[model samples]
Every structure is written in structure tokens, then in C-alpha cells.
Target: MSDGKEMRRPGGRSARVRAAVHQATLELLEERRWEEISIPLVAERAGVHQATLYRRWGTMPALLDDVVDEWSSTTAALPDTGTLRGDLEVYAAAVAAPLQDSLVPLILRAVVLEIRPGEPRTPSRAFRERERQLQAMLDRARDRGEQVPTLAELLEVVVAPLYFYALFSVPLPAADAGRLVDRLLGLVGQKA
Candidate 1:
């Protein structure tokens, strides 16, 4: 993590280097695939020496993981409205707004280009983390006497379409988003 340069460390030199490296990685990712990005490129982009990037991240995968984790964590926490409908609407807005971000499409497109169909695809840690968040939301709803089908199914039926439309260039009208939310709450009500 030293990057061979003595950085003043109030927070510590390592933290500073990591932040710089992440910023550089994110900038590079906007224009190139992960495979095309090299350690030297990251170091150059960050204005650090190449050894520093290696010392901090060790490999491209490690660097990209840190970048994605940092990016994913920036989303605001979902609101907990009393009703399921209200909560879903708030959550939908949070989820949908991110879809409109330019970087999201770039990252998703990079991922798609990197993976071939029929290849065994590992689920991203972010995807699992999001599912966990949704599950927690479901648990909260249940605790509030609001029972619903498994959050996975509900998310697949509702939230997944928003992302799918964004990725595939399908038109996701506000009415469609509202209808999906209605269907999700309808399912919840039926289950209750």
C-alpha cells in the first residue's frame, strides 16, 4: 500500500492511496473494459507509480472489486414507510434513479461484454447484498403484520424489470413502474 511514495498520513497514507487508486480505476472503467485496463494504466491515471497500484490492489480483479463496492455503497438507504405500498414506491425510486446514472450502464455493458453466454456466471456480491437488503425489508414488513411472498420473487417480478429495461433499452414508462409496484403489493395483499 506504500506505493513507494511517502504520503502524509493524518488518516494514513494507505487510505489516501486506496482512494486515489479507486478514483483512477473508476475513471478508466468509464472508457475501457476491465481486461483492457492495466496496472500501469491505473497508476498513471492516479498519478502514482505502477508499484503503488500493485501493492494496494495486487491484481485487476481486486482493484475492480473495490471500485464496484465503493460505487454500490453510495446509494442512499431506503425509507421505511408504514405501508408496503409506500415502502415499495420509495424503494423503487431509489432503485430506478440509479438506473438512469450514466456510469451504471457503462459498468453493466462492460460486464455483459466480458461474459459470454452459457458461461457459468457467478452472482456479483452487490447482487447478493441487494437481495439481503430486500429480504430485510420483507422481514420488517412481516414484523409490521405485513406478510408477502418471498422477497426474491417479489423483486424478480418488480425491481428486476426496471433494471432489465434500463440495460436492454426497453421503454419503462412511469405507468409501467407503477403497475409493477401495484402487482407486487397486490401479491403481498393476497398473501396476507
Candidate 2:
């Protein structure tokens, strides 16, 4: 029976293509600035047609947004261990690990600072989502009778310093994670 509607083929081909493209993007990011990497370069690196990339990703910002989303999906997540301190320790380790990745600062700068011409500054809201996740976690602690401060306060005391040290190429002192977690807990009336 022939129907008017066309049925697309079902396969894992799209997944394979996305993996190839995203991996190629990571490789390119290591050697190229966000503005310098084009669709042709990504396609050549991935062994895919430029047209395919253009069709699939739509624009350079869109593609980069997707790449960053993939990276965050794989790496960035809030810790949900039974207690707040355990959760913060888990997140702190992640921050330290990624700070050493050469690409991390560059990617962070581009996503946070660069405004793509003719497009939204952030096609992905990874930063905002991360903040929201932090807020939700804090809200949970507050619900559990912990006196948590606002997210802004938490960031000022706990998160910003790590980022500052990372941006300046300073190695995180081994005690920094525990110290910051303690300070954050202290703000929430939880003595560590």
C-alpha cells in the first residue's frame, strides 16, 4: 500500500553522525578559536558533507551551542548525595578537574562573552540552567531546616573564587574544595 506521506528510514545513523561531528568539534576547539572554526572545517574534520552540517546545525552559533550542550550533558551536573556537603564536594571536584582542561576557559569565555552577529548571544542557556540547578539544591537544603543564603551569596563565597583561580591559571589548593564547602555550609547555618 502506497501512502502519500513519506516515511524516513529509522537507524542509529543520526547518533553516529552527531558523535562524529561533536568529537570533531572538540578537536577543532583545541586548536581554533570559536570564531575561526567554520562549517567546512568541522565537516572536513568529521568526514561529513558541509551541506549536512549546515542542514543539521543551521548556523555556527547554533552548532557551537549544540556542542557545548553535549559537553555539559556529559560532564556538568549537580550532585545529589544525601547531604549538602557531600553534594558540594562532588561538584567542587568537577570544577577542579575541568579547570585543568585547556579548552574549558576558552569555551567558557566564548559562551559567556561573545555575541554572535545576527543571532542570540547564547543559543544555549547552560549557565542559567546551572544557576537554577544550584538554586534548586539550595532550596532543598532550606526545606530541610538549613539556613541557606541566596544563590548570589553562595556564588560569591564558594564558586567565584575557584573560577577566579582557574582563570588566572592558579592550581586549586588541595584544601580549597573542603574549605569552600565548609564556608558554604556555614552560610547555611550548617557547621562543617
- Candidate 1: worst 10 consecutive residues by lDDT? 1-10
Per-candidate TM-scores read: 0.74, 0.79
Q: What is the C-alpha lDDT of each candidate?
A: 0.69, 0.74
Candidate 2 on 1-192: residue-level lDDT in tens? 142232343235677888898878878877877678889999999999898899889877788788777766667677788677777888877777666665555556546644556667555376776788889888887788767778997788877777777666664754677788888778767777
Off by over 4 Å in 2: 1-11, 113-124, 170-175
Give the top-scoring candidate (lDDT). 2
**Which residue pairs come into collision in candidate 1?**
3-52
lDDT against true structure, model 2: 0.74
| Clashes per candidate, residues 3 or more apart or on different chains | 1, 0
lDDT of 1 at 172: 64
